[model samples]
Target: MDLDVFVTAHRAEWDRLEQLLGRGRRLTGAEADELVALYQRASTHLSLIQSSTPDAVLTGRLTQLVARARATVTGTRRAGWRDAARFFTSAFPAAVYLSRRWWIPTAVLSTLLGVLIGWWVAMNPEVQASIAAPEELRAMTEPGGGYEAYYSSHPAASFAAQVWTNNAQAAAVCLVAGAFLGLPVLWILFLNMANLGVGLGLMASAGRLDVFLGLILPHGLLELTAVFVAAGTGLRLGWTVIDPGPRTRRAALAEQGRAALGMAVGLAAVLFVSGLIEGFVTPSGLPTWARIAIGVAAEAVFLAYVYVLGGRAARAGEVGDVEAADRTASLPTAA
Candidate 1:
């Protein structure tokens, strides 16, 4: 086809696509997702065409339509925020239920209980030396006492580096493990529980419980809980993928992933705060009560942010309840 004719033809087709997308604005749930995807594809094609021709004319009608499409996308996103707000408003009862629900509690308690059983396995004398021994202690501990040797050779900077690196690795693990979604999340929670139990056991055995408390209580609870939240999300996502219950795995996973990601995002922030506390504050020998106080204060802040403020977004109620209910009906169940 001739160049001008081809351009005109393509523009006309694009215009129709945009109109359909505009009509899609009134759609809800899965239809909405489909419309967004379609619009995305059209945008990509437009980009390709624009890139291929430096002097391409911007047809007045097409330009106006693109602007309208962009406005529509913006409106959709704003509406999404409103829907999330409505979710929290309506779901507060659900969150409270999850907090008090027997099944959710049972799942967590059972996981913790299993970790207590594995405490012995992880604390095997051999395992103890590898994980507990500071590798940097080779110089200070006279070839045997790694902890002494480790900190002596390196100033606190090394410890800071190690802590930061480990925390980052844990965060990444929390994220990547979610690929399995919830099962992997369960594994992470178990791993964290075991680590907590073993570390506490070792500290008690050495009678350095105060040192441990000063070091861990300041940040341990928040960090561990955050990790658990991330794991929970991943697990939920994976479970949706596996069972999907009534909905197809794709639909279930998308909804579960949204809720899970929201929770995980909050948890990631906790991870950083915990890292900072562990890195700078804990090692400084802050008083035990001080550590505990700081820990409690942090907990309060997190609670307020998540439950009090974050739950009640400004955009609440913009999304229709009927539509939200439809999405919820198809959405995978997760506490």
Candidate 2:
């Protein structure tokens, strides 16, 4: 193929495509159709040039032109603050609300297990001794000891940031690792509960159970709720692998995986708030009742957000996934 001849033949079409692209949303139906046609023709021309003559300069121009035309023909959906707002109000809450069945039971069972473990440790000296030496236990549970000092050990802002990062990472891992059939999520929950149990047991043995509650409840309520949501969503993802219901296995996994990822972003925000409570409110000099009330109020508001905004969005068909327009078109499957 003669390079000049090929360029001359397709140059008018390429110019038209560029003109349409420059119009940017001002194209009529005819121009839009023409742009797509010209784009296809230019693509063919570029292929021929590359495979035959292999002219670097001509190939470069066509490459950029085809890219711009493709962008114009396909259009882009850039996310802005509006998308963020919709996610928090609709997608995030709807996901949490939908997965409540899994997480609620998880929360109850885990709490019971923690309490049981605490009781065993408090009542049995062997259990306590097995956990830690007697002197270490006393230092942890005694007044103004390690357990209470843990909160005030760092600056509030830095502590909150650190807590948020750690919790967010945990939630993300739960959501992602759920693909491995949820075993990891359960183990993470068990470790969390076991740690809590150890704390409760030590404090109770020292008659400082009330102090533990005072320190923990302010942030633990919301913190644990976020973890449970993540764990439940992850368990649901794993179960989807086992039983995809009406959808194909791939389709079901894709849908749930997308929702789980979105839930991660939302859960990060929830954890941030809990971190603030833990860092500032938990360590503050306020009365225990006031601190607990703040935590309770935050948790209540979150639940209402899920039940109200999330329910409304779910009823309207939001499923915590990306907008329909943004999703890849799935191949049709036979029933």
Candidate 3:
């Protein structure tokens, strides 16, 4: 257990590994084999020192040395388009499908809450009064009112981009905030639904409920579904903090975190589609039923993507995590 003596004995091997890593020249077969042997020995030395008689400076040096050597040995591979294709086709949906239990209920509850709040606001004049003044409500609900005018107020392309950016940011926040036990996610969802309810109430009380549904249903169905998926995945992540099951807390969180990140990306694409519908279809002169039919079709396509491709991937044991080879190698632990 003499640290100085151990360093003296293995210093040559460590130096050799370092030299091999630093060299710009290609290594010969024998030299490459030797580099591998030296890297293994250095790794063993680092483990022993970490476990017993750990020294800060020596440990740090060895840590860096081992990392460089390991990377050199493995060789790095940059991600290509194939990775993107695999991610969309397999990883993204599988992640969503696996987290369905959490988000599906989230969608149901949030919708019911929106409806309840709408009903309350519609039935109770006081609630409507608290939300907005009579003049404001009238301005919002009159024919060619604010609710209908809002969508067409801007150019379609710019408006779609703006909506996409905003929705994507919201979804990202939901996924990232799950680290705080999902409280933020729930609050965000509540706020979103409350706003929807307020609008519903104002329109219904104006006897323009049909007008409101027609406008919202065109894009709201798919748009809100993406938000629900994000929120649900976040809640699932928060629950992972509470119950990591058989896996160590760190491991479970790490796994879920990766999946959540992937979901963030996939959900952005979903939100983009909804944004297009909202920007173009919602404000168009098409009949309400036709616009709603378009929205329903988009929602149905997304759901099918999740259940069909995602379900198949999940059944085949994809958890939406990165490939094993891409994961960081865990250090050796004592039994």
lDDT tens string, model 2, 1-335?
Answer: 78888778878888888778777467778877888889878877876666567788888988899777766767876889999999998999999889988999999999999999889888999999998898998888888899999999999999999999999999999999899999999999999999999889889989999999999999999999999999999999999999888766766898999999999999999999999999999999999999999999999998999999999998899999998756543434556
Kindly list the per-residue Cα lDDT of model 3 for residues 163-242, writing each as its tens digit.
Answer: 99999999999999998999999999999999999999889989999999999998999999999999999999999999
User: lDDT winner among the candidates?
Assistant: 3
Q: Could you tell which candidate, 1 or 2, scores higher by lDDT?
A: 2
Q: How many backbone clashes does candidate 3 have?
A: 0
| Better candidate by lDDT, 2 or 3 | 3
What is the Å distance of residue 228 in model 3 from its true position?
0.7
lDDT of 1 by residue, 1-335 (tens): 24466566566557555656657347668755655665554555444444344244653444455555555655643347775664555443233223323224534774566456445634565655655464432222232243223323445556656665676566556555665644555566666676566655555445554555555677776666555555544554565666777655555555555554444444444666776766666655567788778877886676665555444532353211224423322223243
- Candidate 1: where are CA atoms >4 Å away? 1-15, 18-111, 114-165, 261-264, 310-335
Worst lDDT run of 10 residues, candidate 1, spans 136-145
Best by TM-score: 3
Model 2 misplaced regions, further than 4 Å: 1-74, 331-335
